[model samples]
Target: MCTETALRRENGDRFCLSTAQAETLLTGAPWRRFLVIGDEVADGRGEPAEGYGHDGWADRVAASLRRIQPGLAYLNLGRKGRLAAEIRSRQLGRVLEFKPDLTALTCCGAELVRDPFDADSVEAEFDRVVAPLRDSGGDVLLVNWFDITRFSPRSSEETERLRIRLRELAERKQAVALRHGAIYVNLAEHPAAADRDVFGADGSAPTMRGHAIAAASVIQGLGAHLTGAGDACR
Candidate 1:
């Protein structure tokens, strides 16, 4: 079981989930296998957090699940620099083979950061990647980007444009979630994501503090399903 831990926010506010609380929060969750797939975000790529170990949000989430179930199976098929299409082509097959009941997906950022991004094509690829999971009765967790534009060293106008682009991506993600009945957590829109410190110095991946925020969101989103307050998956 997890000991007392603080998932901190940038504004001096901290969210703590102790061992008992974590156990309660995740007890009865029907997750025997947890699979994470996507790009850099999915890989939890970033600098080591100040106090937290050098793991991504998915690791933290898996750790919590282990504390509760002790035997939870977790695998991360995420790689840095992989675009959405590559993720769908390379990772999706192995993912289906895993027969995971719980899964996390994120990848479009590779396209989002590049010039000449085709929103519709990326969205289509994402749909293809997630639809099978949704149909296979897997509980899907869809995480979007953080507000990393705030960390951009570009000119103010360019930075604002990047923010706008992020907002567009968030909208598409929400639509996809609604279409697939998946739980969507848009860190780009989260209050804590507004803190530039949550991003790494590279302005692409998250810092350790950012990972904490992502993990907390995943747990909180699952609480309803885990506690039987919402839909339960097989």
Candidate 2:
């Protein structure tokens, strides 16, 4: 199911959108072009055994937006196993060329969870890509890294340490997003992130149902922004 709720900032301020406000945003001045860039999760990469049904969360968001504005242009630049820097190098230029009204950027998960994680480098690359899009007047949706430890069967010290590092990286990225006036979606705190059903065998990439949850989260985040709640980020 779609998880819709108010988002709280690190400073204790909360941002929310009422049902009527969300309805108004959906039906009023809807975005016409949607663009996505990131890794496998955003690419909707699942095991071949699972069989592909959905394209990914970005596509789901596009479908929902299309209902409000017909003939919406959609593009998905997500590639499996791509790191944040790689995404910035490959897809950033194309994103500018597309000039989308709305852009969803999901990066850094692949970098943060691996060995020799460099939080600063990842965040710098994120800003390099996102800053330009935001300057171009695109509504950027920045998705934070989720806690993959929740899906892990082991409870070792190493696992705990990795989780801590991931959280730190997420916080840094969220700060950058908010600083740039982007809509930040805190997937790490979402209840669905811990659900086994929401993930595939790899325990990282979201399943089809998981993508729906992600899509709903993005919509709710956008609704909050359109309704004036997200202005607090400024």
Candidate 3:
């Protein structure tokens, strides 16, 4: 069994949990197997200028897991520029095949570019992607899509409007996760750790640092959830 360790959050509070705590809360009472799916943010698919690389959010989460539980295994199913509809169509099969104890899904900026103003379609895509995971008895965690439109100087105003749309999508996605009892993390709302440099030097994709920090945040948050003490309660 895993052990519980005390943890302190920035806002002031105490909590504790261990890998064992994660194990305890799981449905099958088995060891942890994590599968994370996201677009560029999850995969670290930036250009040459950005400091982050193949070591995207998935890698960060894996590293954290290794530190928390040496033997834990994780699989990152991140694809660059993957819209919710795209992931729903292509990645769901592989995700179900893995049979992970926990799965985290992230996307948003890409969707804004791809789907634009299609809110209903976006919601449908989320439903399609998440339903199967829940039906399979897997513990699902949804990471609300992060938006960088506000950070762009030229498109700040347009991006801010876009951010509103993205925020609405995030809220809808969170509602779905909550309705199904899945863990939900709204990275979009995390102002303290927002990706200031959301785009790279070439102005194409998310930077490596962006991916790493975002992924790390998820890992730490999940670790806290698993340990029962809110270890990464940033």
User: For residues 3-69, could you state the per-residue lDDT of candidate 3 as single tens digits?
Assistant: 2122122112112123343333432223367788878666656543232334565665555556555
**Per-residue alpha-carbon lDDT of model 1 for 1-234, expressed as tens digits?**
224244233223364344466567787777889999988888887777655546678998898888767888999999988888898899999999999988998877667668886777777887898799999998888888777777787789978877777777777777778788887776776688677768878776688778777777777778866555542222
Clashing pairs in 3: 2-20, 15-229, 16-229, 17-227, 18-227, 52-208, 224-231
Q: Candidate 2 on 125-198: residue-level lDDT in tens?
A: 88898899889888888887457777766568867887888788878878888879888888788876766867
Best by lDDT: 1
Error of 1 at 13 (Å): 5.8
For model 2 the TM-score comes to 0.83
Q: Residue 210 in candidate 1 has what lDDT?
A: 80
TM-score of each: 0.88, 0.83, 0.72
Clashing pairs in 1: none
Q: What residue runs in model 2 are displaced by over 4 Å at the alpha carbon? A: 1-25, 47-55, 230-232
Rank list by TM-score? 1, 2, 3
lDDT of each: 0.76, 0.71, 0.61
Error of 3 at 113 (Å): 2.1
Weakest ten-residue segment in model 3 by summed lDDT:
7-16
Question: Model 3's lDDT to the true fold?
Answer: 0.61
| Per-model root-mean-square deviation over C-alphas | 3.3, 7.0, 7.0
Give the clashing residue pairs of candidate 2, or none. Answer: none
Residue 142, candidate 3: C-alpha displacement in angstroms:
1.3
